[model samples]
Target: MDDPIYDIELEDCPICRGAGLIQDEQGWSVSVACMDCGAETAHAEYRTPEERLEAARRVALLWNMGKVVHTGMSD
Candidate 1:
């Protein structure tokens, strides 16, 4: 679980370089955390309750059939 955030960042994810996923050793496959903000190729940090709610709303809209599809999604 993530704590609420305030500041929103548009920076590249250092972990995935804003790719929103990590690739396999052979680069044949990739997977997303499906929880982190950067999974959308953009990230938001909600430090406050309001911001957290906003983030949650955004997350809710990302679901397809109640399942998150984060891999290969980029801005």
Candidate 2:
């Protein structure tokens, strides 16, 4: 299956400059997380396919804007 979230461009981790990943929980919500420092954006919940895409986009935007929560490392 091709998830549209994968099509969205994401910025590197604000804390570690590592790769970012789009993660979903049980197909209901999405968030962007850093692969190295574990920084993440707030979860965007969705109820439909359109919402899912929008949620993905929202998180990606937040990530690119450097609005992320770093829980693994000190800033």
Candidate 3:
């Protein structure tokens, strides 16, 4: 099976310059997180798959804008 794609674009982590990942919580909500720094954007809730994709995009936008919350783990 192929990996599901969200078609979202994200920027590198502002804290650690690492990759960003789009994450979903049991199909309920979506957010973007840094792979190395653990910085994350605010969660966006969704219902359908379309909404989930949109939510993923929303978080990606936040991540690109450097609007994520640093978890302090990078420090």
Compare the candidates by TM-score and give the number of the best one. Answer: 2
Q: Write the residue-wise lDDT of candidate 2 on 1-75 in tens digits.
A: 877789999888877889999999898999999988889999999999999999999999999999999888666
- What is residue 31's positional error in candidate 1, in angstroms? 15
Model 3 residue runs over 4 Å out of place are 1-5
Candidate 3's residue-wise lDDT over 1-75, tens digit each?
A: 343434556678977889988887887998988878788999999998777777787888888999989885545
CA deviation > 4 Å runs, candidate 2: 73-75
Q: Mind sharing the TM-score for model 2?
A: 0.92
Whole-structure CA lDDT of model 1? 0.36
User: Each candidate: what lDDT?
Assistant: 0.36, 0.92, 0.81
User: What lDDT, from 0 to 1, does candidate 3 have?
Assistant: 0.81
Q: Write the per-residue lDDT of candidate 1 for residues 1-66, one digit (tens) a residue.
A: 343321222233434443223212122222223344434322334555565556544543333123
Instruction: Look at candidate 2 and give me any clashing residue pairs.
Output: none
In candidate 3, which residue pairs clash?
A: none
Which segments of model 1 are wrong by more than 4 Å? Answer: 1-44, 65-67, 70-75
